[model samples]
Target: MTYTAPITEQTFVLETVAGIGEIQQLPAYESATPDLVQAILVEAGKLASGVFAPLNRKGDTEGAKWNDGAVTLPAGFADAYRQYVEGGWGSLGADPVYGGQGMPFVLASAVQEQLTSANMAFSLCMMLTQGAIEALGAHASEDQKQEYLTKLISGEWTGTMNLTEPQAGSDVGALRSRAEPHADGSYRITGQKIFITWGEHDVADNIIHLVLARLPDAPGGTKGISLFIVPKILPDGSRNDLRCVSIEHKLGIHASPTCTMSYGDEGNCIGYLVGAENAGMRAMFTMMNHARINVGMQGVSVAERAYQHALAFSKERVQVKRIIEHPDVRRMLMTMKSTTEAIRALGYLNAAAVDRAHGESDTEAKREWQALADLLTPVTKGYATDMGVEMSSLAVQVFGGMGFIEETGAAQHLRDSRIAPIYEGTNGIQALDLVNRKLPQGRWKPLFADIRETIRALPGDGDLGAIKPYLDDGLAALENATVWLVGNHGDGFDDAAAGATPYLRMFGIVAGGWLLAKQALAASERLAAGEGDPAFLKAKIVTARFFAEQIVPQGTALLGPITRGGALLFALDEAQFAA
Candidate 1:
């Protein structure tokens, strides 16, 4: 119930570890000067703390209601959404030519973390809309853009991504959704799509759904899928045949409607193609790649929210003279805080990489920036979401009996965080992507070089005197793992696959340590110069030390699992598990 945007910490990460200043130098982001960015963060913080934070508990309690194929969001949600639009928050990172502020994605990401921390369920609509904007901007035809982009950007309408069905969850190639060509050049769509977030809601006049279905003569796999723009309101202002057949009673994100949409129930539902035929997966993935980072931010958000909740609770709920004074509770709080900050920096770093990729004009620089961004994406999503769950659970522990109850709201954060790792390509899939897709993308060497350089840049004999060795060990472990994985990639494919999850976790741990160390070095420099806020700077050093000591060591321990083949995991027969 208590939350304040960590604007100062976020700003620190952006300017320091994430290279925001360099990003600002880019021509495309010249408009986002330091003062303007600070002002935006200040205003965004006010809205997040004032408008959205108050509604979070209420939304979770009241939730979105489904009746007669329509969803009614809890009271004040529509008003908050309107304010969100009027304030131009929704269009910050969208293209300027299309009714947006055209801010850099890194800056937008900072604001997004604040929103998600304040009210995650409410933020989901905005996140999905951002994805829709990206997909439409990238692939939608000019006519489609003219018809939909501005309205969606302005928040007069919203969007949904429909990819899942009863039979097809992760296996998109198995989908049975069919799209038949119409005389008017549109396609008649018929299928049931489930777990569509913000799929059906009344906050906006229309919902533009980016759907995936197959043509009758298309191939029999993911290769044949085609993307469609199916709207709730037809171009003629008539109602489309698509309807929300039902809304899932979910474990969390209670206020965000997850609909099971039935398209063309009467065989009159029309859809416009987004990209070329048999290219639906590519288009959908464009939106998905955008969503994955935001989803990772969601993890950071909930963890942040939970940490604040626990810190407040620990300070107030006195046991043996303030629970935070207890060693074990202190340890838990430090773990939560340090991990959250580390991942926050990682997320910002990822965002900054993405920004550089977009804004950089040089061909080679752009490719390198994009590679860094791609490399961090899976780690950011997988590790941060996993940390979110861990931090949220730690919050419950801090609250003791109170956290278990819904009234305390700690449990809600855990429940909400649980879905993040499962969705946006489950963490397991993220690991596989890290090893199979990202590692082979040929960025690991440069990425590892960057990591080592960061560690090497730290003051070896200064205020962080004792922590340097652990960070070194962590970096060494990561390098060894990377070498093993890459060396054995072809011949030891099964071993690499089995160790993929831990390997990614180790990647995050080392990356996080490097950033935290960078932050610590900055803090120490400020302290030595007798500049900036001494108390905050000192705390940064301590947090970094805590991470170095407590967290970095885990990276080395994962080597055992990394080299172990999947034989043990797969040795038993499917039916033998019950025995």
Candidate 2:
């Protein structure tokens, strides 16, 4: 099935659930008028469907090619990237001083969803580049910004983050890469980094690498680590002492090269430091936080694509009649539909929080919004990604035997989505961050109060009313789980950690239901006033009701496991597992 952008659904979620109107009221985003946002989305959808979607299958089949030390993308990828650059898609939400369009992040997020849904592998290059732009914009020196920001924002060059090594996967402090002070105030970097996405490619003029390495007199662990800018091509136009030793042959996203990068193989790799000495983690988090949210969007993106694919197939494929007419198939489709919408709502809502946190001028409001964003970040990343995997698997199940085959393309969605929960910090880590870190910050009180207010404000006598009871139950369960986890977090860290995963899942379901309930209210009001498309608005109400009835209860059901503690989890001795 050909990919089609769900513009109507996205716009509805943006305007109704995410409060784009309120976002635009901020000084930083006042220029993001509704007409301009619509124009941008329309053009982005065209680029996604017309240019990128066609390459999805070929990218999977052909994959990226690696020669002696160079990486080449699948056919037509370079051209697609060129179109992306030429159209200025990468400049949205970037700093205006650096030649960016300076659009709101929420609007840019909506555009990214369409792009990622069209071709996930192909969209990864842009994602990494944007992350680099953010890191440099926030941490790099004035000279560094002048040199790199414009080109990176304009898509003339691409960027990467190098954090992993053979022995130091999640334990970044264990890395052995070295950076020694040079004669000209620069540093000489020497290390072998792995799992570098789009680390080396022929699509752009140069690849800017943001690498983490330890200095000569630096202390042991992450504190001593410093961030460096190691470019494939130096300022003097000489080839830097770095090369792509090899690229990994992955399970999916085959078109995007995952390279094992070798720096200073000849012992002369040039490097420039970013930010203060021994403050790499702080700088890296700026990029990482940006990436974490985008990864959550990736979950929404792949799930939406999978749903569209499955829904299209169900309508076309017939056994006795159209598979969509079958009760079982219809259930699967509704599960996919309602779940996708819920996550999309959560993801977009999180994006709005980011915008408010950055753009809000009021000190107290900004702090609150930042706290809310931090709280939602982990839940959005963890729950949406786990659901991304489940939804894609269900999409494959809709095709039955044909899904297991390579030609049908359903299996690839599952394979591609599998990495989201692993990268950008694993979902387990996200869960722990949610319960162990965010919960202790005391931010959940205001957030919970807001959810309760929404529940109270929901009318009682229509479709919106149907959502109130289920949403209230889910919120109550979340509150109970939050109180239990917070109590255990101080003295029983293990117990809190043990239940963190389910706690995050429960939180996501409740948050998603709340956002959808808001959307349902908006849709109902529009229907009553005879505004907008009746059919679309009606579908919105139905999808929201379906989620409240079918999915919200799952949040309530998770409360037991969340409060069960860690005794059972640690009951078995490590060495006795085989027994």
Candidate 3:
């Protein structure tokens, strides 16, 4: 099935739920006019559907090949990447001082949704590079920025994050990589890094790796860790002391090479420190935070692709006058459609918060926006990814035996979606971060208040009135859960931790319901004014009502889990698990 970009739906979300008008009002983004945003979305849609989507099946089928430490992508992959570079797609929200287009990130996010929907694996390279650019922009030295940021922003070179090792996994502090000081003020990084995405690829001129290692005299654990810039090719055009030892044969995203890299094998891996010594985690979080949001978008992306694939199949497959005619099939389709839309709304809303956090000049306002962004980051990443997995599975079920087969391409979406929740920190980690770290900051107070205020302000008539009771119920459940988490967090940490996942799900469900309600209200006003397409607007209202009625109730259901504490979870011992 050919991928089609949902430009109209994306535009509606941006204009209605994401507050793009407020983003455009910011001084830095004054040039991001509605017309320009629309044009960019249109062009991005073409590239995503035309160039990228066609290669997705081929990439999955052929995968990437490795030979003697060299990696090669499937046919058309490199050419498609080259087209992506020539189109300046990577520079949309990049720094204008470094030859970027300097548009708002929300627009870039919409573009990313389309690209990811088209080809999840191929889009990863760009996503990682964008993260690297942000990290370097925040912490890299002037010389380092000049050497790296320009090329990265231009898409002339791609980037990778090397934190996981054979043993380190998610415990970054456990990494054994060593960095030795050199007479030239650079360092020699020596270690083996594993699970590095796009770490070794022939599609770009060079691969810039952001590696985390430790110094000999530094303290133990994470406090001693430092980040380094280790490139495949040095400035003088000589090969750096790094090589892709091997590429992983994985369950999904086969097109994206996950590499085992050996650095300083020849004892000459020249590297420059980012930020300060032993401050690697601080700098790396910059990249990780950026990546986490995009990973969430990946969840939305795969879900959309799976939904489209299943919807198309339902229309054509004739099992008693087309499966689309069946009520059960229609229910599944509606579930996929409403959930995907909810996730997309959450992702875009999060991106807008990022834009506001950065663009706001007032100190207090910036802090509030930043806090909101922090609170939503894990929810966006965790909830969306979990739902991505669920939606893909539903899509597979929709296709029955064909979904399990390779030719139908329905399974690919399922396979490709399985990684989002695992990477950029696991969904479990996101939950812990939410309840343990973010909730304690008390930022949720204003945010929760705003949700209540927004719900209260919404019109209580017709479709809006139908959704209000569900919204109120969901919000009440979310508030009670939040109180339970906070109260238990200090005296009963394990209790709070156990309930984190459920609490996060509740937050996402309620937040998503709120945004969709807002969208429905906007669509209603537009319909009354004859300002937009009636069919689309009415559909928006219906989707909102569906989500509120069907999905929002789950928030209330999760209240039990969110308040249940760790007694049952830890009651079973290690042997009991096996038993």
Candidate 4:
């Protein structure tokens, strides 16, 4: 709000709700003390607030220029890119063995909030590059990792996930990119990949494209798919056979290039295998654990941006006064604040769970925490992005006429945040995964119990007394919906198809409310010691309270539809209207 990056709110969540302090005991994470994290964040905030953020409007207005084969990015993007890499922010959470800082994922995630909030389109290159680095780290040969991981991690080069093809979008099974075996144990890839981010760029030395292709005699569909390290440069280190045929010219994030890549046009796109044959899906997914969370943060980041602008407009624009403070405008303002705060808490909570899972050394604790992360990742991505759109809309309402003007940046927030729900497996897909994959997957009941116990361990206090009851109710609703799903999941999933989105919404409220409660406890501790900022701590309590009392009720209300609403989902009477 007040057109500022919610850094104070963010730190409160990390230190209080997410418990960044507790993370220090974790091995490899000992360096990320609260003080160090604060120092990193303070530096990160300056870049976010000053360098990247000032360009949001410019990027949107100027966009990226595509002429012939080269795409010229917005002004200062190159400088920001250089600074980001030099700062080692790219490899903060990566293995120290590869020249990374080896900070906890929690800190990296927190810092990323500022990055994307500043400018998501510009940051997409960094986000995809990290995903490629991760895939190489997990599945690439030692030689491959040595050659690629350092620069990619250092952000000297960017990366892309080349999954979507002409025929395949959400359906991975429809991919037809081919990888042929060569004499030198490498593979030659020939394919046309569409919707490739940073497919070719001058911001970095090389563009690493993790192209998915099918090997000869490989099984059909997704199983046949293999991941390849198709660099724009040759193994002997010359330019290769990939071309950015064209860049997409629509929608938000215009500063980022979305290319159609033509691989092996000259039979020269030598693609090296990262993992074993046909294990491409496994290798691709290695990056997903964090990639999903990063996309979710985009949702959080843009929401904060939109909310900040909206809140500022509401406070300053004096159209009418004192309907005891213009109750109508006040309602719009309050809704914007509450929705953004609720979803922000959810995203931070998801980040905290990820930190716990990645940072914790104890095997059992790790598994349990990982389960919580699994549960919340989809919710954070789905609900938070949707909230961003809502919050952006409210920003427009507050600004009235000016919000409609593109110059105000209010309209752009809505456009940019809209994609969060669509991408990262779509919100609907995320919902289905929650109900069908997570809840009923073999003997994983312990997963739910693990989360519940950890949540309970972080108890509320007298001030938090009002928050607990609804949180408890929300948790119960989650339990009931989970049980109902396990019992009634239909064969091939057609009967239960329609409730996916609502289920994800239910999950977000419970998961977000839980994280806020955890933060509330930590804030109370900090308040007692007088170590935290009072305004932030107070906002933390209020936001958490608002979510539990006002928003968490959705979890319970959703149970009615989950239990008895499936038939209506498919009752469209196909013959009713012949257009």
Candidate 4: C-alpha lDDT: 0.78
Model 2, poorest ten-residue lDDT window? 515-524
- Greater TM-score among 2 and 4 belongs to 2
**Tens-digit per-residue lDDT, 1-579, candidate 1:** 968999889888988887888988999999999999999999999999999999998988888999999899988999999999899998899888889888989889999999999999999999999999999999999899989998999988899899998899988899999999998899999999999999999888999999999999999989999999999998899999999988888889898888999999999999999979999999999899889999999989999999999999999988859898999999999999999999999999998899999999999999999999999999999999999999999999999999999988989999888889998789999999999888877897887787777767776575577677888888788888888888778988888889999999999998898898889989888888998889999999999999999999998789888877788999999999999
Model 2 clashing residue pairs (backbone): none
- Per-residue lDDT of model 4, residues 463-549, tens digit only: 477787787788888788777677667663654556667777887777777777777766767788997688777766776777777
Counted clashes in each candidate structure: 0, 0, 0, 3
TM-score of model number 1 = 0.98
What lDDT score is found at residue 450 in candidate 3? 77
Question: What would the per-residue lDDT of candidate 2 be over residues 1-579, giving only the tens digit for each residue?
Answer: 478889999899999878899998888988889999999999999999999999999999999999999999887999999999999999988989999987888889889999999999989899999999999999999999999889999999999999999999989999999999998999999999999999999899899999999998999999999999999999999999999999998999999999999999999999999999999988998999989889999999999999999998898898999999999998899889989999999888888999999999999999998998999999889999988999999999999888899899999999999999999899999999999899999999988998899899898967888989999999999999999999998889999999999999999999989888888888888998999999998988888888999999999999999999999998999988988
Residue runs of model 3 more than 4 Å from their true location after superposition: none
The predictions' CA RMSDs to the true structure, in order, are 1.1, 0.9, 1.0, 2.7
Better of 1 and 2 by TM-score: 2
> How good is model 4 by TM-score?
0.93
Compose the digit string of candidate 3's lDDT tens values, residues 1-579.
699999999999998878999999999899899999999999999999999999999999999899999999998999999999999999999999887888988899889989999999999999999999999999999989999999999999999999999889888899999999999899999999999999998899999999999999989889999999998999999999999999999999999999999999999998889999999999999999999999999989999999999999999988868999998888899999989999999999889999999898999999988898898899999999999999999999899898999999999999999999999999999999999999999999998887888689777788888999999999999989998999998989999999998899999999989888888888989999989899999998899899999999988799998888899997888999998
* Deviation in Å, model 4, residue 45 alpha carbon: 0.7
Q: What overall lDDT goes with each candidate model?
A: 0.91, 0.92, 0.92, 0.78
